[model samples]
Target: MVIGILKMDICLPHLHSLKDKRKVLKSLMAKLRQKFNISVAETGGQNKWQRSSISVVLTCNDSGFAHQVLEGVVREVENTIEGFLVKYEIEII
Candidate 1:
């Protein structure tokens, strides 16, 4: 099996509270899981209300498929989140 992991740093411009941050993060995570069949969560920057770093893990039988799926998920995230900027890195193991 091939495992693909992607770590993304997302910046939310107008998030004011932890509740709002959690709600946005939850919605983004749900969308990622539903659309790409991947597991995503906030791996870092959780204590702050404006910035979040989310990590996504995708497993598949083929490395190529895993990469494709990760790429698709990244694109989906970029398209779905408004005024959100992301810096991401992907690794296959």
Candidate 2:
């Protein structure tokens, strides 16, 4: 099995409250889980509204699939989040 992990740092420009931040994060997480069949969550920067970090993990029989899925998830994050800027790192094991 191949495990692909992606760590992403996302910046939300207008986030003010934890509730609002969580709502947005949850929506994005749900979408990623449902669409990519992967596990994703907020791994860091939970308190701050303008900055957040998410880690996404995908396990599959093929490495190529993992890579493809990671790419798709990154694209989706970019498309789904408004005024979102992201820095990401990906690893396969």
Candidate 3:
């Protein structure tokens, strides 16, 4: 099996509170999970209102497919999310 991990550091310039952060993160996570059929969560920066770190995990039989899915996830997030994607990394193992 192949395991792919995608980690994203994002900056939410418009968010003013934890409530706003949670709302945006929840929607983003839910959308990613449903669309990619993978696991998504806030892995860091939980206490900060304007910064977030999100991790997405995918398990599959093909590494190429996993990488492709991760790339698609990144594109979707960058296009649709309210925050700026500061950086991202993808690892396959």
Root-mean-square deviation of each candidate, in angstroms? 1.0, 0.9, 0.5
| Local error of candidate 3 at residue 18 (angstroms) | 0.5
TM-score of every model?
Answer: 0.93, 0.95, 0.98
- Cα lDDT tens digits for candidate 1, 1-93: 899999889888888988999998899899888888888989999899999999999888999999888889888888877647568998999
lDDT of 3 at 77: 95
What is candidate 1's TM-score against the reference? 0.93
User: lDDT per residue, candidate 3, 36-91, as tens digits?
Assistant: 99999999999999999999999999999999999999999999888789999999
- What candidate 3 gets wrong by more than 4 Å, as runs, is none
Candidate 2: where are CA atoms >4 Å away? none
Q: Which is better, 2 or 3, measured by lDDT?
A: 3
- What residue pairs clash in candidate 1, if any at all? none
What TM-score does structure 3 among the candidates reach? Answer: 0.98
lDDT of 3 at 28: 88
lDDT of each: 0.88, 0.90, 0.96
Q: What are the clashing pairs of model 2?
A: none
Clashing pairs in 3: none
The candidate, 1 or 2, that scores higher on lDDT is 2
Per-residue lDDT of candidate 2, residues 1-93 (tens digit): 999999999988888888889999999999989998899989999989778999999889999888988999999999999757568998999
